[model samples]
Target chain A: AQTVTQSQPEMSVQEAETVTLSCTYDTSESDYYLFWYKQPPSRQMILVIRQEAYKQQNATENRFSVNFQKAAKSFSLKISDSQLGDAAMYFCAYPNQGGKLIFGQGTELSVKP
Target chain B: SQTIHQWPATLVQPVGSPLSLECTVEGTSNPNLYWYRQAAGRGLQLLFYSVGIGQISSEVPQNLSASRPQDRQFILSSKKLLLSDSGFYLCAWSVRGRRNYGYTFGSGTRLTVV
Candidate 1:
């Protein structure tokens, strides 16, 4: 069984600053995928970024990027130029070959203006 | 482009009442469907997943059951609801491409059992 762990329960970032949420996972499979999802107050889960296990390079999406360390099983998400709208519960997820996502407990991010 | 939908957005039901939640996908075919439950302040719990019609896999033993009557449609049901079953229900799907990608989730259903 694969499990994703998000150590931070809550995080806060000032407007225009940057924030990083930590994530780690336990997986026996050599091939897999990592993802970060954001859920706003609307309760809609949106995909932020993704990293392939075989890819040594980190995944970046404008302001959202991931530091994917396959050896350590660590995948962290970084949000730059953070805005008020960036406030949401961020979840780190793992998807194996079987196609089911194993999600983390989630980190509630608050942005202060 | 593929999209997933789940309803109703919010539901309130009494204990021992029958429960049914529906999920459907559009713009895709032969996709993998999944049902997940999230307890308050917890991670996603895999309830069931279907690779094809009539091929459902159960992850956890519970009072709930799932059915895939159509290729893009999945349903979650319970003959009698339990208070512990109250949580956010999410439906997701993924394609069977060469490389596995992240899943696309629905808006999610908030089930409140009284």
Candidate 2:
């Protein structure tokens, strides 16, 4: 069984600043995928970024990036230049052998001006 | 372009009432379909998944059941609703062999069982 953990229940980042949301997981598979998703007030789940286990280099998507430490089973998301629109509930996800997504308790982010 | 549709947006039912939620995918064939339940302040719980028509897999042991009558259509149902079943239900679709492409989710349906 694969499980993802998001330690922070909530996070606050100032407008135009940066913030990092922590995530960790337990998995035995050597090859898999990790993902971060955002849920806005409209309740739409949007994919933020993805990282492949085989890739040593972390993945970056514009302002959203991931600090993936495979050895420690840590995959954290970093949001740069946080904006008001970035205020949402962020989820860290792991993939199961059946290709099902296992999500962690979401971290609610608030962008303060 | 592929799209997944799920409805209705909100449902309010009483205890022991029946439940019927539908999900359909467009612009794709034999896509992997999934149904998830999201409780307030909790993570998404995968309830059911289907690889093709007439094949459904359940992740959790619950009162809910799922069906895939068509390659692109998935349905979730229950004989009677429980207060614990009240939550936001989400439907998602993805390419069968390319899970790395991630999943495309529907707008989600909020169900409240009183």
Candidate 3:
């Protein structure tokens, strides 16, 4: 079984600053996928970024990027130029071969102006 | 482009009542469907998933069940609802393959069991 862990239960970042959310997972499988999802006040889950375990290079989507360390089984998400809209609950997820996602406890990010 | 839809943004049902949450996918075929439950301020819990029509797999044994009557439609049902079942229900769809992108989730339905 794969388990994702987000040590931080809540985080706060000043507007226009940068923030990094830590996530770690334990999985025996060699091949898998890691994802970061954002759920805003609307309660809609949106995909922030994705990283393939086979890819050594980290995944970047504009202001959202992932520091993926396959050897350490660590995938952390960094949000640059954080804005008020970035305030949401962020969840780190891992998908196995069966496409079932195991999610972390989630971190509530508060972007302060 | 693929999109997923879930109805009744919020549901309030009495205990022992039946539950039927529907999820449908558009602009895609043979995609993988999944159902997840999330307690207050918690992570998602995998309840069920379907790879194809009429095929369902249970992740955790509970009072709920799922069925895929159509290729694009997936339903989560329970004959008698429990208070523990009160949580946010999310429906997601993903392409069938390891190399495919991540899953696309619906708006999610908040079920409040009284």
Candidate 4:
């Protein structure tokens, strides 16, 4: 069974600053995908970014990026130029080959305007 | 350009009452559907997933059940609701062999069992 762990339960960042949320997972599969999802006050889960295990190059989307270290089983998300809308519950997820999406406990992100 | 829809943004039901939550997708076919639940201050829990019409896989054992009556439609139900069942229910869709495309999620349903 694969398990994603987000050590930080809550995090805060000043608007326009950067924040990084840590994530680690336990998986034996050589091929897999990692994802970061953000759930806002509206309660909608939105995909932030994704990294394929085979790709050593991190993935970047707008202000969101991921630092994926396959050997260390670590996948962290970095948000730059953070905005107030960035405040939310951020989750790290991994989907098994069977198509089951496993998630980390989640980190609540608070932004100071 | 696919979209997912999950309804009854909020629901309040008494204990032991029957429960039903519906999810539907548009602009896609033969997509994979999933049901997830999020308890307060917790991670998302995958409840059920369907690869095709009538083919549903449950990830957890509980009082709830799921059905896929149509290719893009999935339903979660319980004959008798339990207080533990109270949580935020989310529906999502992904391409058959390319979940890398990311899960397009619904707005979610907040279910409260009294």
Candidate 5:
């Protein structure tokens, strides 16, 4: 069984500041992939970033990046220069053997101006 | 560019009524289609996925069922609606053998069963 865990239920950050959302996962598969998705107030699920388990290099997409520690089974997302529009719920996901994703509970982020 | 479409952005149905939600993908063929449900303030739950037309794999056991009548069309149906079925339903797709790319999701449909 693969499980993703987002320990932080809610987080707040001031505009232009940086905030890090923590995520941990358990998977027996040696080679796999991970993803971060954002669901805003509009209720649309958007893909944020992706990281390959075999790559030691972290993935960065403009203002979003992930610190993936394969040994520790940790994958954390860092948002730089947070803006009001960045407020949303974030989910960490891992795929199962059949390609079905197992998602974390999610972290609701609020940006304070 | 591939795009996914889900219909009936919002729906309110009475309990015991039959239900059908349609999802279609454009600009892609033989894509893997999936149905997921999300409760308020919760993560997504995978309901069903299809590798090809008429090949459906159910992730969870429930009254809700899914079908893929065409290459890029997936339908979610229920013989009878239940209050527990009320939630936001999302449709997603990924390229075959490219699951690492993640899924492209639809805007989603909000269903409310009374």
Candidate 6:
């Protein structure tokens, strides 16, 4: 069974600062995809970023990036220059054999101004 | 552009009541549809998914059931709702073979079982 683990249940970041949410997973498949999703207070899930296991280069979106270590089975999300709107719940996900996503417990991020 | 719609945005039902949550996707055909549940303060859990019409897969064994009558219409139903079933329900869709693109989620439905 493929599983995603997010050790941090809650995280705090100051405005203009950077914070990294740690995520690790267990999977035997050599080729797969990883994703980070954000859910704000509105409860709308938003795709933040994604990383392909076959690609060695990390994936970066404007202010969000993922440190995907395929060998270590780690995929961490980094929010740079955090803003107040960045406060939300972050989930790390890995797809199973059937393409169904296995999500982590999630980390509640609080951005302080 | 593609869009997913799930309704009603909020629902309140008594225990043992019936449930019918509808989800529809537009601007795409033969997309993969999924139903997810999120308990309060928890991550989303995959309840069911469909690769094509009438081809539904259950990831978790529970009281809920899902049906795909049309290519873009997915429905979640339950004969008798349970208190444990009270939570947020989300509908999502993605390209059939494009798992790398991730999923596009709906605004989600808040169901409260009293």
Per-residue lDDT over B1-114 for candidate 4, one digit per residue giving the tens place of the 0 to 100 score: 788999989999999999999999999999999999999977888999999989989888999999999898999999999999999999999888885887889999999999
Residue range A81-104, candidate 5, lDDT tens digits: 999999999999987778787899
Off by over 4 Å in 5: none
- Tens-place lDDT digits, model 6, residues B1-114: 899999999999999999999999999999999999999989888999999999999988999999999999999999999999999999999888888879899999999999
Cα lDDT, model 6, residue A90: 96
Give TM-score, chain B, model 2: 0.98
| Reference-based TM-score of each model | 0.95, 0.97, 0.96, 0.96, 0.98, 0.97
Residue B41 in model 4: shift from native, Å?
2.4
Q: How do the residues A1-113 of candidate 4 rate in per-residue lDDT, one tens digit apiece? A: 68999999999999999999999999999988999999999989998899999988999999999889899999999999999999999999988888878899999999999
RMSD of 1: 1.4
C-alpha lDDT of residue A95 in model 2: 69
| Prediction RMSDs, each to the true structure | 1.4, 1.0, 1.2, 1.1, 0.9, 0.9
Q: First chain of model 6: TM-score?
A: 0.98
Q: On residues B6-112, what C-alpha lDDT tens digit does candidate 1 reach at each position?
A: 99999999999999999999999998899999888667889999999999999999999999999999999999999999999999888865335668889999999
In model 2, what is the error at residue B49, expressed in angstroms? 0.9
Q: Model 3: per-residue lDDT, tens digit, B1-114?
A: 777889879999999999999999999999999999999877898999999999999999999999999999999999999999999999998888853488889999999999
Candidate 5, DockQ score (0 to 1): 0.81
Q: After superposition, how far is residue B26 of candidate 1 from its true place, in Å?
A: 1.0
Q: Where does model 6 sit among the CAPRI classes?
A: high
Model 3 DockQ class: medium
Q: In terms of TM-score, how similar is model 2 to the real structure? A: 0.97
lDDT against the true structure, per candidate, is 0.91, 0.94, 0.93, 0.93, 0.94, 0.94
Among residues 3 or more apart in sequence or in different chains, the pairs in candidate 4 whose N, CA or C atoms overlap within 3 Å are none
Q: To one decimal, what is the Cα RMSD in angstroms of model 6 from the true structure? A: 0.9
* Fnat computed for model 1: 0.72
